[model samples]
Target chain A: MRRSERLVAMTDYFKENPYTHISLPFFVKWFGAAKSSISEDLDIIDAMFEQLGIGRLQTSAGAAGGVRYIPDYDMELSKEKIDEIIELLEDPQRILPGGYVYMSDLLGDLKQLRIIGKMFGAAFKAYDVDYVVTVATKGIPLAYAVADVLRVPVVIIRRDPKVTEGSTVSINYVSGSSRKIQTMVLSKRSIKENSNVILLDDFMKAGGTIHGMVSLMNEFNATVKGIGVLAEAEDDEEDRRVDDYISLLKFQEVNEREGRIQVARGNYFE
Target chain B: MRRSERLVAMTDYFKENPYTHISLPFFVKWFGAAKSSISEDLDIIDAMFEQLGIGRLQTSAGAAGGVRYIPDYDMELSKEKIDEIIELLEDPQRILPGGYVYMSDLLGDLKQLRIIGKMFGAAFKAYDVDYVVTVATKGIPLAYAVADVLRVPVVIIRRDPKVTEGSTVSINYVSGSSRKIQTMVLSKRSIKENSNVILLDDFMKAGGTIHGMVSLMNEFNATVKGIGVLAEAEDDEEDRRVDDYISLLKFQEVNEREGRIQVARGNYFE
Candidate 1:
């Protein structure tokens, strides 16, 4: 194949399989190109990727190593994405009854979800996340998005147990906002023992659900490497149950009567 | 940028934003390259994409015309993916106590989900789908996957209404397998009136959940253009409530006592 065609093919492969190690011989065989030619093509793609501020192709030495795509969205680009999200959130029409912001529409947008996932993936890129864990309903998409970028599996915690999950581990915790006890269940085979995980959620208020997730991770002996939320609402500091996490957007205020909403970049920017 | 670098960036763009039209001038301005150079670069990438059996870049002429990536996974490659899934599903170890197959692991796999999504996307590519819809929980990821490939937003129906959803439209439907009536809810704003949507689910037994979804879509006056499921199981033909849907895999049988499982490609292959 010519250099241009090889570049297109290689770029597609790297994008499709992020963080997966591909040996040099495999590429040479697949592309029917010389080792030197493949190496040059890698360098070109790598340079272009970095120049675009998405990420770079990390290459390793020796027989067992080749190259892998480490996807990263720089702070500047991530800021732009966050700003776009903030703009969407600031629309007064999104304000629901009882000061709740209607964000199902935003969460439903695949393009926006991909950006949010990439940003969270960038935030936790340094952590070796074995699985992206989230509670079902809304958080499922965010977890899958982050897993997509990190090339990891997503473990979803369900509100109720189902026959299809086989045996499961269940936990009950008080929801911070509602102060209601809720049960979260996960299949016994979902996560390996002592694995590292990143907890993600679509929204956070008083950190009840996130706190619950952290407690559930303890059951599997998994370490919570990081936590991320798409948006965090302001709550009493004394009511907060969890800390040491990242968020992309913050809800400073939402007044239903006034038809007003105030949103800003989350603490992750700080 | 040079043609080589342009190919890398353009390929990334098309992969990220499939089914979204982009004018040629937008590419020219974004790349700081001449119009002809951008056009030539698109041609190179399009040809390579087709040659790779992924999809092709479609272009239109005249005013308000542009190019878009129509992602299509051909039948041969799709069969290979289905076979891989079948190998995993056929493992007897996956049988649960009630003869249910454990598939959360496969569903959690992003690579597998992406492949499944692409296969479904290809199957419904000709349909002018406005939104990809699914019931919440397990099907959320699959819905997002299809939406990602189709470049459309996802609409998730919930089991119960939440405050964050604002006002909702709900319906009661009998679950075919369980023979119990269940409530399915969608936010009033989730889908616009008279929209076209595709229904996706992770698994189907008697198609109760999907049937419930179709009923909910009716409340929004949205048309169900297509239905796709990752897997379907053998059931009494008289008991099945849903037909005319596409599935990737079929659960021929699961014998708990014998620890045997049989899986085959879905009707989509036929």
Candidate 2:
């Protein structure tokens, strides 16, 4: 009704429905405001969003023109978040048996996942991602988080097939770490043909899983527009199968005997 | 910043960090605004949130007092969303072989998941929930969605234990439909003892998986505060293992031969 009220309501709507086009008439009718008032409201929200380092409301000019919220995080803010995550990963208590660092805690944290997802979303924001794809279990949350920011659906590839999935496309690939053949399955109806996809994973070692995903994308005639991982572990240069991708954190070492760990910002910063 | 700018930034902050208390001074320092101005800005946002039927900002009094956003959806609005979902589920094309419904499209949708998660969050808002728990794969997104709204972490139970999980606690339980014994494994450090949790799932048939989750929660001495499912199929009254839970959709019938599907709002409305 009022200017302040309209600002709050419009801000919430834009946040909830990012990348969704809302016509001036739609807002005018919804809020019982004039078209000019709606336009002014958009400008204010857009300016504040930029000032807050979130993103901007992209308004196109034409008969089909409307405003859409393009979510983003400032590069500086993203770097700060990555530094915070690196500090968390460096904790010695996170060292597990063998050489694996315990990151399930961070993975399970919604706050951390949001930060990681937004960073990945920012990294891959240039690509036209139809669906955020990831293998099941740990990668599901990360995939959804990125998809949420991109305003796209998340297509999860499962390790084992299930009845509810209906018809599926299954692929077998070697595990990067264990070099054992493993299976990844997706429902045939999950993605449209010739669509663009962004592949995401929680962790990457030899990049086998990501490589497998790229191959699977080929099966559906979909393009692998981007690849992003939350953390990448050190592996031999020759053993690393996938070369091009973005990562937020790097795991340098994990000494189980001494309960020590080393981590740093991923190549995205570099 | 001015009132309008502060309104936009403060609204974004409240939406991002729900259920987390922020002292009035924090806003003062962050926005470079006077205490009175910050209070007025908060009042404007709080009033608009209620007017929008999203939720209210609860402000406490005294030295330990501040504001926290408690998100909620209007019951009438939630019903409209449910009806829309019912229409989508009722499409005949969703019928698969073996009388199964193809819902991966809906499950993959971030918009649908957010609405469903908010409904579940509102249902369990009265309870003191420390975590949102679900089994791996399809339920992971729903778990994260609900956890995001509740401002808590998610703990996923794997179908099989992994070496990366460190020490795990596992239990064998019978599958609700197939009557086959299955195992669910969780990291020992996932859930703190005596914590409260809300169980979530994509679908439920005989509730065996949920039943198993309840058993596992007992091992950790945790409380199952609430159980929410996206959909539940019709099961024999005697076959239903778990009785106390909330579901958004109910699958009444699926005739694969005729490509017919029947769906309706779940018991939450009833």
Native contact recovery (fnat) for each candidate is 0.93, 0.88
**What does candidate 2's lDDT look like per residue over B1-270, in tens digits?**
788888888899999999899999999899898988988888999899998888999999898878999999889999999999999999998887788888888878999989988998889888979999999877898899899999899999999999888899999999988999999999999999999999999989999999999999999999999999899997543689999999898888888887888888999998
lDDT per residue as tens, model 1, B1-270: 788889999999999989999999899899899988888888899899999889999999888878999999978999998998899889899999988888899889999989998999899999999999988788888888899999889988889999889999999999888899899988899888999999999888888898888888888889999999888886644578898899888888888999999998999998
Mind giving the per-residue lDDT tens digits that candidate 2 earns over A1-270?
998889999899999998899888888898999988888889999999998889999998888888999989999998898888888888887777888877898989999999888888778877978999999888888998899899899998989889889889999999887899999898899999999999999999999999999989999999999889888886544689999888888888888888878888888999
What docking tier does model 2 reach?
Answer: high
- Among all windows of 10 consecutive residues in model 2 chain A, the one with the lowest summed lDDT is A230-239
- Sliding window of 10 residues with minimal summed lDDT for model 1 chain B: B231-240
Q: What is the DockQ of each candidate?
A: 0.90, 0.87
Clash pairs, model 1 backbone: none
Runs of candidate 2 with Cα error greater than 4 angstroms are none
Alpha-carbon TM-score of each model against the true structure: 0.98, 0.98
Model 1, residue B193: what's the lDDT?
A: 97
